[model samples]
Target: MIRRKVVLHFPREKVDKPIVSKLVRDYNLDFNILKASITPKEEGLLVMEITGEDEDYRRGVDYLEACGVEVQPLSQDVARNDERCTHCGACLAVCPTRALYLDGESMEVVFDREECVACELCVKVCPPRAMEIKY
Candidate 1:
């Protein structure tokens, strides 16, 4: 099966509501909540990992965009950054996908692109701006 990381930026309230539920139920896609940064009963962004057939993936994207959610395909290059990296673990905390982790012994940041949803939260959290989306 083809897997795609779809990032949805919307008000926090919109998540776990009818809109998200419909997408999950209708598409029959596997999804995982990666990040939630909104206040209680307020707006926030949600990062989700989606996996399904190509057709279903496209349709899912279309459906989400129609609902006014900013959606995009997760880029692998963005998930793995070799340069401008300090491995400070700042990105680790913000990563909703838990794709980035620091080696406790080495004190280095490790990246698993497969687990990344490309929410760009890592890019936003990196102090040195080391993380980048290749495409």
Candidate 2:
């Protein structure tokens, strides 16, 4: 199986359609919605992780494109600057995946990239502005 994180932009007219659901029913793909902003008859945005066979994933993407949904890799990738971080532990409280944690002995904040889903929670709470989201 192939796993990919992506952001889908839905045109105003397509906002009410069950596009994501079709990927599951027709393409045999599984998705985890990390974030979403969808309003009926308005532009919508979806951040999700999709898993499926490589070919199914490709075909699913094509299907989405055909439906006029713009697809792109997840753009909000959060990165921490070690030098700017104060180890204030503010991020630990907001990280849903426990990607940010404190080392018991060192008393410093540690970031685990693999565990992170780029949820943008850490970026909002970092007082020192150490956490940055790259587009």
Candidate 3:
């Protein structure tokens, strides 16, 4: 199975559609929604991790784009600057995904980029301003 994080932008008209469910039923992709801001009749955004076979993943992405959903990889959204970080572990509290954690042996902050869903919770709580989100 392949797992990848992606952000989906839905137009106002598409807000109420059952689009995500279709990805599973039609394209055979499993999805985990990390964060979402969706209101009927308003533009919507969803951050999710999709898992599937290589061919199914490609087909699901293409299907979303064809239906007017803008799909972007998670790398474009969040980043951490190691040089500016103090490893204070402040970000760990607010992280919903447990992406930020302290090393048991060293008591240093450790960030796992792959597990990050780009929710930006760490960005607000970081004392040294290490977390950054790109709009």
Candidate 4:
């Protein structure tokens, strides 16, 4: 089995298409939508985690590309600067993925980079301005 988080950019013309559903019906892939902003005649953005067999994952992604969906990894290159981090645990409160948490021994916040899905909730709530998004 394979699990991948990706952001899908659907063109304005494709916004109303049943593209994502094809992943489930045709590729036997399961998905969890983290966020979505879709409008007819306007661009659509969908962030979702896809889970399926390895071969199915590849085929599904290929299908999306063939359908004119711009597929990209979920991460937005978010970085945390320890020097500027106050570790007040503000970020821990808003992180939905358990990406930020307080260490039991040291009381400092620990960041699990692999677990982060670039939700940007931590960045918005950080007080010391520690979290950064690198384009």
Model 2 residue 135 CA deviation in Å: 2.1
- Clash numbers, per candidate: 4, 0, 0, 0
Better of 1 and 3 by lDDT: 3
Sort the candidates on lDDT, descending order: 2, 4, 3, 1
How does candidate 3 fare on TM-score?
0.84
The top-ranked prediction according to TM-score is: 4
* Reference-based lDDT, each prediction: 0.73, 0.91, 0.88, 0.90
Q: What is candidate 1's lDDT per residue for 9-108, written digit by digit as tens?
A: 7756566566766666898777777655666776656656677788887888888878777785544456455787877788877887678988889989
Q: In candidate 4, which residue ranges exceed 4 Å CA deviation?
A: none
Number of the top candidate by lDDT? Answer: 2
TM-score of 2: 0.84
Candidate 2 residue lDDT tens string, 4-76: 9899999999887788998999999999998899777678999889999999999999999999999999767
The residue ranges of model 2 lying beyond 4 angstroms of the native Cα positions read 103-108
Is candidate 1 or 4 superior in lDDT? 4
Minimal lDDT window, size 10, model 2: 73-82
Question: Mind giving the per-residue lDDT tens digits that candidate 4 earns over 18-88?
Answer: 89999999999999898899876689999999999999999999999999999998867679998999889
Query: Could you estimate the TM-score for every candidate?
Result: 0.54, 0.84, 0.84, 0.87
Q: What does candidate 3's lDDT look like per residue over 12-105, in tens digits?
A: 9988888889999999999999889987767999989999999999999999999999999876667889899998888888888887899999
- For candidate 2, the clash count comes to 0
